[model samples]
Target: MNTRDLQAFVAVVDSGSMVAAAAKLHLTQPGLTRRVQNLETLLGMPLLDRQSKPLKPTAAGRDVYALARNVLVAVDELMAAGAPDSEPSGELRIGVPPFLSELALERPIDRLRDAFPRLTLRVTAGWSPALVQGIERGALDVATVMVPASA
Candidate 1:
């Protein structure tokens, strides 16, 4: 019915309990429960199956939760954009080791998206020596290289 209701429901789904979600939202447990209940009433369907362990969301809840998460993510991006001191924005040229590209790129890329939504990440993948060379030549702003201890 509203962002507040949807936020409470999503928080409950994410936190796995009204008590936990309440703490996360800084609301009383009863208040969070009533917000979720209000959402269910407005939708005319139950969003949560309280009988399930870990408090699984109902099928309808899953659908609404996904949309709510997207809405919240966009809201977060908007808030970040308005807070210049808290927001980081720039272009970063990063040279990554070839193997690490497949092994470790996902999380860092996601973090960059979440933390610096306005920033651009230019990534070049190659062997450590090549990446290091790029960094040394100032072609890359940052590079990660793994080498033998003797080097």
Candidate 2:
């Protein structure tokens, strides 16, 4: 199966309409529809509920959606792994304390951006406990936490 076809199917499901998906992908509606159809044909099942208003995915489609998302993310990471300079790509979710954000993150964040132009940074400022919780829950890729010296 073509990855482009999977991407088109995922985009259509995500955007809830072929028109929006196509617009997001910079392709014509017919082109996007063709891609989805190609995927469906390959899988031998209908992935979409055509009669539904918001373009809900069928049972098989839901499974495909979840798997396709994993596949796409893996593909992106694989590409980044082979990238020159070993520059990281994809989203970096960072959690930091409010004090650190205000006092120390500015220049470091700028440097990170300069170093990894393809990386999308999402920074959240929160308390140490909350930031640590985010890291534990996999909601954050990394976080800084401070503990009392006596503790």
Candidate 3:
């Protein structure tokens, strides 16, 4: 229902117990449990099997959990993008030819860091085919590949 509830649910899933989730979330166990309970109440179904030694998600829980995780990720990305220009940060995954990567990345990366201290740049170097595959697979957001002039 809310970010806190979703976060609590995720923490419980990750930690495998309410106590552990509370510790991870820096909240009291009861508070964390209540958050999870509230979420289940809102959804009108039990999310976790408390009888299990290590809490396990029910089928419904697993489905809700997946959606909650995605929602939280989207919210975080939205918040990050909406942040002020002072916090100009993004993850840029790029693929480049080995030689071009070696030559071109240094000065541009340095200049980018100077301009936007929080920016994170990830560069992967590979042959043309691999670079192109990475781009197609979405592993690389952008890529530069060399093709024969005749082709």
Q: Taking the tens digit of each residue's C-alpha lDDT, what string does model 2 give over 13-41?
A: 99899999999999999999999999999
Once superposed on the true structure, which residue ranges of model 3 sit more than 4 Å away at CA?
86-150
Could you give me the TM-score of model 3 versus the true structure? 0.63
Lowest lDDT sum, 10 consecutive residues, model 2, at: 79-88
lDDT per residue for candidate 1 within 33-78, as digits (tens), equals 9999999999899999999878989999899899888887677677
List candidate 1 segments past 4 Å from native.
83-85, 88-98, 101-151
All candidates' TM-scores? 0.58, 0.76, 0.63
Using lDDT as the measure, name the better of candidate 2 and candidate 3: 2
Give candidate 2 regions above 4 Å deviation: 52-54, 98-111
Clash total of candidate 3 = 0
The candidate with the higher lDDT, 1 or 3, is 3
TM-score of 1: 0.58
Candidate 2 residue 12 Cα shift, in angstroms, is 1.6
lDDT of each: 0.87, 0.93, 0.88
Ranking by TM-score: 2, 3, 1
